[model samples]
Target: MREIELSLNQTQKIRLKRALEKLESLSSKANSNSNASVSISDSIPVNLEDGVLKGHGTLDLNGELVATVCGVVERVNKLVYVRALRARYKPEVGDIVVGRVSEVAQKRWRLDIHYSQDAVLMLSSMNLPDGIQRRRTALDELNMRSIFEENDVICAEVRGIQHDGLHLQARSQKYGKLERGQLLTVPPYLVRRRKQHFHHLEQYGVDLILGCNGFIWVGEHVEVKDDMVEDQVSKPEQQKSNKNSISLEEQEQTYTPIETRQNICRIANAVRVLSILGFNINIEVIMDTMNLSSSLNLDIHEMLGSEFCVLVAEGEAERRSLTKRKG
Candidate 1:
């Protein structure tokens, strides 16, 4: 049977997710009549021939535009085409995507962004040897992973969309690379379509890499590998093989005290108050403008700056709103 696919926006996707959850929650509240009688009017509005009336059998709807189908849905290409609203996206070229820095090659990185296959980055895509005439490295063998490093969150532009994956290129000096911090992954069903700048974060390190195939990895930073070792472990390869095993101490993460957090917040709040007066947000810009001491204000701004920077790095403005929400 012929079928149709429903395309929805980010708002529609979030709405559907919430609606589905609500239905599951209210399952126990179903009301039953003492003498249940089958009524054609109450039954799902099913029609095999002509199209069913728009929104025939809606159970729970937050907004009028969103509704569930009360009839049969056909499956094509393994996708069930229901008479319900759905979120979708269209692929295009030159779209900037914030994907997890997956496998880093000699000159490229593979992004695990829930696509058919991994995306690739080629050498000569960055501004490293910028404004110069010749290539930066004389050695053609310089590895890409070493330059960008593995799992270093990065922002790149989609050069082309392929059946397998995306052909990506890094943007300018401003729009590449990320540090260790928290991230969020929204369900692919909730995302509407491909966006231009998708690494939106809200005054935090919540970088997002929305994928079309519905796979996203939310991580602050890829934990650096355990390359650090005891004195003996760094010995030559042959010498290490000749020696016995070495004991490595586990490193405990140092936690920031609550007092420290409060102090930072106090200064940040003060800055926010001043920001209401039309001051810019950059740490240097605001600090110099306000003549606030960096010893105090700079630290707080640095903390908040990381969060705000991620919001500006995103592919879409609407998607950034998701990051702006409080915990």
Candidate 2:
């Protein structure tokens, strides 16, 4: 368990301690049958006759498989490995990830996806704004910064690892330059891979993207418009105004509503509390936490206080217990 440093009174401390203990108890009971936490040098049992294959975080010493790191033991058919709770993000093909542009290379943008190495986003891999399906010319290479520049946050898919390095692609409009949002990072282990990572909270008018690399993006929702339609509508207007002149529509687009901004902060604080408590982070859990705070009429900043944290922990424990019973 992670220790939360807060200016908590004696009563708050006792409640928090009790809540955390309950959470720990529930988690241990649920995972007891399927998983086992091990420390370095802990001997892992294996059927020697089956000829076990040792994977990462495990070492074969004197015909015994022992853990090389402190983590939970995972078995995949014949392969046995340890999954470290705290580690760098490992990329997988087709996985949606959010990253920041580290360098704008000649034809590719290097992104830091919290991986062992920086991921590459090539100019040729992504769809251009014009929605054209043509070859990337030298002009495209020269105007690469027009698409993405240094330190710009982008969402892309893990294309695959090439000879150069891990490559990312933004073939869809949903998979590019994030704006007007807070980026919160938690341990990758807390964010499990799921079928759908993109969520549009219509009620709050917010977008939540649970990036596979443990990058949580909470921003105002931007409707995905057809590129051809947008181009057709804007071309005539573009001809009327100077290219450098900013339009009123563009200015309004840049301005986020105060209500939406508050919702973003409130949702973001829920994530922070969940991460601090080491709970599994997902869209449902995040929304539930937000609802809990709202029902109590707690302010956004108050969500991070010791009392709210304790309440969240207790609620989580109760939820998990009910889920286990139903199962």
Candidate 1 on 16-63: residue-level lDDT in tens? 445434432332232131112122233332342343334333332232
lDDT of each: 0.40, 0.84
Model 1 CA deviation exceeding 4 Å by range? 1-90, 129-143, 162-165, 193-327
Q: Note the residue pairs that clash in candidate 2.
A: none
lDDT of 2 by residue, 124-195 (tens): 988776677899999878878777888878888999998999988887766778778898988887888898
Give the TM-score of each candidate: 0.37, 0.90
Off by over 4 Å in 2: 226-243
Q: Total backbone clashes of model 2?
A: 0
